[model samples]
Target: MLIPALCFVVMITAVMQTAVVPLMPDIATQLGVSPNAVGWIVTANLLTATVCTPLLGRLADRRGPRRVLLCILGVVLVGSLLCVAWDSLPVLVAGRALQGMSFALFPIGVAVLRSALGPHRLTAALGIMSGTMSVGGGAGMIAAGLLYRDGDDYRRVFWLLVVLAVIATALAWFVVPDSPGSGTSSGADFWGVVGLAVGLSALLLALAQGGTWGWVSAPTIGCVVAGALVLAVWYRHERRFDAPMVTPALLTARAVAPAHLAAFLVGIAMFVQFLAIAMFVQVAPEQAGYGFGASVLETSLLYLLPGQVVGITAAGVSGLLVRKFSADRVLMAACAVGVCGFAFVGFAHDRPWQVIVAVAVLNIFVSVAYGALPAMLVEHVAPHDTGVANGINAIARTFGSSLASALVGMLLATITIAGTDIPSERAFVAAFAIGGVTALIAGFTAAASRA
Candidate 1:
């Protein structure tokens, strides 16, 4: 009951992030906003999630996770209703921002799981929880495709979100039990939180908008420099504080640092598969030199869904592997398989079924690493640090995803087919090549980790 409740929470959060993607153009048309403005729907939500995740994780550490979980659920539920009630763009974006806080639910739930479960049961449980992230993302895309097929009205999606949030909140209230040592008296680092918020916001904003705003533009460059300097100061502040929000020592520890590195690289490779493959499969062959001319529904059902299913299965397999061997080894082998998968996609994506196989192959490492990275970190850290530690790791993966998006945008834009806006086949091959190399590097990093 406990694990199922938490997995439901994880799925809902993931669905909230992904479900709006296919509806963005319709949302823009209905709201009378430019394409750039419509992008703010996603940007605002991600930025809010980036800033709020660590803060909420810290709060969960002090208060009980169940309490924090319910509060976030309440907020997300309200956000969903707000979207349903409002037709204004600003109001809708605001609602989405509130929904973004759901990102923290994963780490906070992880804290609860760690406290409640024993060593024997923890790895398999974490694997299932990790699998939900991918499952929820796939579900979101499929749901959006099936519902509101050609409409400016996306309220139906939010109504469904509202219902799911209600169910999850109810289940959590009953199933998630209180854990010991939750009511810690230590105060949060006000300056640390502020610094992280400011620094990450500036940095992620730059990454998120770099393609649209020209990567070398003054605003992008300025944000990059400012974010770096602020983070540098924040690092020093954390090191000197009596009880920092994140312990610098723990971050730098050999056992934990590798998990962060592997997560970042895996994030980049995973996004390449997700974003690049989606675009490649959807481009009409008549309009472009390549691509299957698949609709959004076909892309989601035939291509992306298989990978997601494989990802969930891979998570379970990874858990069993971790039980027999070590998390580090499992991560290493998973990444190695990922390299082969990416290479296969690079050379052989002419057929639709080939793309599906590629999706499944790439997800093997992506899902395994998602499970193994946190499991590794959880084993190394104390219970009190669980939420913030995982929060930071989540931030790393988010950062990597942002960078990957920018990179893929650049790659696909570099060489379009003739006068059409469609990307050439060469661009996709290059993207997959990059993914393969990144996975190779990630594998080596995991293998070298002392953990």
Candidate 2:
């Protein structure tokens, strides 16, 4: 009951995350904004999520998972309602920022599972929760695509999200038990939260806007440099602070560092494959020289949906494997699978079927990899610190996802055809190559970690 309830919460979060993706163009058109400006809808969410996740994780650690979960769900509910009630671009972006809080739910759910479930049930539960991220994302995309396919208003999608959030909130309240830790914090580290938020926002803003602002522009350089400096200071502060947002010792430990590193690398590989395949399939074959020109619905249903199903199945398989073997070996194998998937797409994405195959393979290993990662982290950390540790891991993955988005956007934008704005095949190849190589490195990194 606990696992299924948590998975439902994760699924709804995933749905909310991707539901607006298919509606981005319409959102721009209706809101009187440029497509580029509207892109911030997603960027704003990512930035806020990246910053808030770890902070929220620490709060969960001190306060309690159930309390934290309810608070986040409340935020998501408010955000969804805001989007549904208002149609303005700024309002929408603000709502999305609120919605970004949903990312924190994943780590909190992991913590809850760690506390509520027995040791024998823990591995499989984590796998399902992690796998739901991908599955829910694909499901959300499909739902949005279908809802907006007939030129319907985009507000309907937000309305649906609102309903889902409400349901999830109720389910979580009733189904998730209050474990040992609940509302017992001295007080959160206010300074640490502010520093981390400001630093991450600055850096992500620079990355997300760098192409438009010019890579070497003053704003970009200032943000990059300032963000780094602030983060450095934050690191120092955490190292010395008695009640740090993140424990310096846990971060520096050999057992934990490798898992975080591997999470970031796999995160990059995951997003690279996702964005590349989604874009590749949508390009008109005649215009791009090698694309299927699938509609949003077709792309979501035909290309991504299958991979998501495979990912869910693989999550279960990975959980079993982790129990029989070990997380380190399972993670290494998952990375190896990622390498193959990306390599195939990089070298052989000439047909729609090829793209499908590549995406399916990538999703399979991504789920497996995600399943193994938290298990590895939990093995080293104390049960009480589960939320913060997993939250840090989530932050690492978010960082990689942000980088992947920026990297893919830059590569495709710069590698456009001479007379047209369409990206060339080489752009995709480069993206896939980067993903493959990163996965390969992640595999080696995972293997190096203590089993």
Candidate 3:
């Protein structure tokens, strides 16, 4: 009962990331802007989410997640209403930033559960929680696509979001027990907070603007370098400070460091597969065979396998696997299967059903590992570190995603098969090839971890 309820709340956290895809063309059309700026629709939310996650995670550790959850829920409510009421693109982007603030809710909820849920339920609960990030993303995309069949559709999506928030806010306020150790932390880690904000801001700004600025342009390179320097300085400073954002010791832990590395690798590899696989099955082009000119709604159905299903499944499976198998082994096995799924795309040129099979396998891997990672990290560190540690993972995910988007765009530009230009199907194949190789490395890293 508690598990199901938590999954719903976490789902709400990721709603913005995927839910706006179908509406993008409409939004850009209405706002009178180029579709390329459409990337901001995602980057804006991601940037804010990446920056705010640690702060919210840590705040939950201090004040109880109920308060934090309610606060973020309120922010989303405002964001949704603002988007609906305002006609300006800049205003919509601002509203989107508020939506990003809610991203921390999922990870913070995980920390809350870890501190209180019975040992028996903890493993499975964590898995479901982790998988929700992807599951929520996929679910949001489907929901948005289904709702936005016309102009009136965008309004319907927000009204639905509003209702979900109202329900989730109620549940968080009432159903979950108070988080233990909610008052464990002291006042804010000021410098730690500032450095993380400045660093992430610079980095995300660079990535989001690189498409416009040219990746190697002076402004773009400066933004990237400044971000890197800020991050490095923050790590060193946190190592020496009293109440560090993420304890330097945890970063160095044999169990914990591998988990961080594994998370980053997964972030890089998984997102590329997601974009490529989605593109492969739907794009109508001359370079590919059996090009299905599916609508946004139709294309989404083709890939609907276990990603959304895994939001609920990972928790149950994690408990079973952790009981009999090492989390390390289970994580390895899941990632190995994900790699195979990605590899399967190379052979799925004309077959759309085969792409579904691939997504299911990849989702299973993501579910198991996502569940195991947070629990594993918490095992190695004090309770307070969960917020910032998870924050780092969030940052890595954003970085990985930004890199994947850029690389995929570049691949589409360069890779060609015959004298005839290669279709999007082949570009997808190239991207998946990279994902499979990266996930294979991730599998080895997870399996070899000291945990």
Candidate 4:
């Protein structure tokens, strides 16, 4: 029961992170903002989540999962409610900040699963846990679309999130076993956490908004430099402390850095592909978007359904692969599949089946890559510091997301045919090719990692 419940926590957070994908154009129409400006809604949330994840993971190390879980749920619940109350786009962005904090559930859930679940369940447990994100992402899109006109208004979607988040919060407090070392540890390096959080937030903001601000803008440059300085000081401080907030020694350890580097590159490659592929698949008629002539909700359903199905199927079969082969091997093969999928996307023309096949293959690879990463990290790191180490992993993913948002956004903005405002298929082709090449390189990196 708790195992499934743990998956629920992450799935729901994923929904919070992604629910707006289907609604981005809708939100822009509603707010009278440009679609590009509307991109900030997702970018803001990811950037905030990027900065706070490490802080929250470290907090969980000291305070325990129960407390961290409850608090995050509380944030999500309030955030949902706030979204309903606030009509302004900026205010909505603020609510998303709270929602972004909800991502702590991912790392915190992994921590609890490690401490409570028996070894027998570990392999199946990890894969299924990752599948929840796929499920949540799919379900969120479908529900957002269906609920938008499924005899209910989009407001119903907000109300539903508020209700479900609250329910999850209540259940987490009661059902989760307040396990050992589940919460905050002593002398928890408060300054270190604050500096990292602030630094990362500024850095992510710079990256996310840099496109709008002009990359050469003083604000952009200042934010980047400030973030670097804070992190520089953080690395120095961590080197001297026992049980440092981030466990710096692991980062520099001969074996660990290579594995971490692989994870970091994989994160960047996957996220760019995720954002780009989905948008390209549904490319608007004028822009070579899928031209499916589908409604937003309808398009979202098509966009989401295949990925969810692939993730679920992979979870069920992961045990076989893990028993017979190494997780590193599984990760490499998955990356290879992702590269193939992206390549197909570059060439996917009118054939809907082609799109489906590529998406399915990509989802499988993504499921395997993310599902296997933390397990690999845990194999090498001490139990007590796994949360922090995984925090680094989470950072890798977030940093990757920041880069993707910027890169994809700039690419889209760049490739729009001059004066037509439509993305040239040729430009999109280039983007797809770049994504495919990046994925192939990441595959090689994963295959070669010492882990």
TM-score-sorted candidate list, best first: 1, 2, 3, 4
Error (Å) of candidate 2 at residue 109 is: 0.5
What are the lDDT figures for the candidates, one per model? 0.84, 0.86, 0.73, 0.72
Q: Give the per-residue lDDT of model 4 (tens digit) for 81-118.
A: 88788767887777777888877788788888878877
Candidate 3 error regions (>4 Å): 150-153, 180-188, 285-290, 305-307, 310-315, 416-424
Ten residues in sequence with the least summed lDDT for candidate 4: 149-158
**Candidate 1 has what TM-score?**
0.97
Q: Write the residue-wise lDDT of candidate 2 on 87-171 in tens digits.
A: 7888888999999999889889999998888888898888878887756777888887777765678898888999989999999
Candidate 1 lDDT over 25-75, as tens digits, reads: 888888889988889888988898999988788788877788888899999
Error of 2 at 93 (Å): 1.2
Backbone clash pairs in model 3 (N, Cα, C under 3 Å; residues 3+ apart or in different chains), count = 2
Which candidate should be chosen as best, given lDDT against the real structure?
Answer: 2
- TM agreement with the true structure for every prediction: 0.97, 0.96, 0.92, 0.90
Q: Write the per-residue lDDT of candidate 3 for residues 1-451, one digit (tens) a residue.
A: 6777777887786676667866877877777888877668677888888788877777777777767777888898788777677677787788788888877877777777777777677776777667776667677767776777865635577676777778887877777777654465545678888998899889888877776788899998999999999989999998889777667766676767787778777777767876676656566655455456566676666575445575457546765786467567777887888787787766775666676677777777766777767766666666766666666666666677777777776677566555755554567778888888878888888877853
Error of 1 at 122 (Å): 0.2
* Candidate 4: residue 276 lDDT (0-100): 67
Q: Provide the lDDT at 110 for model 2.
A: 91
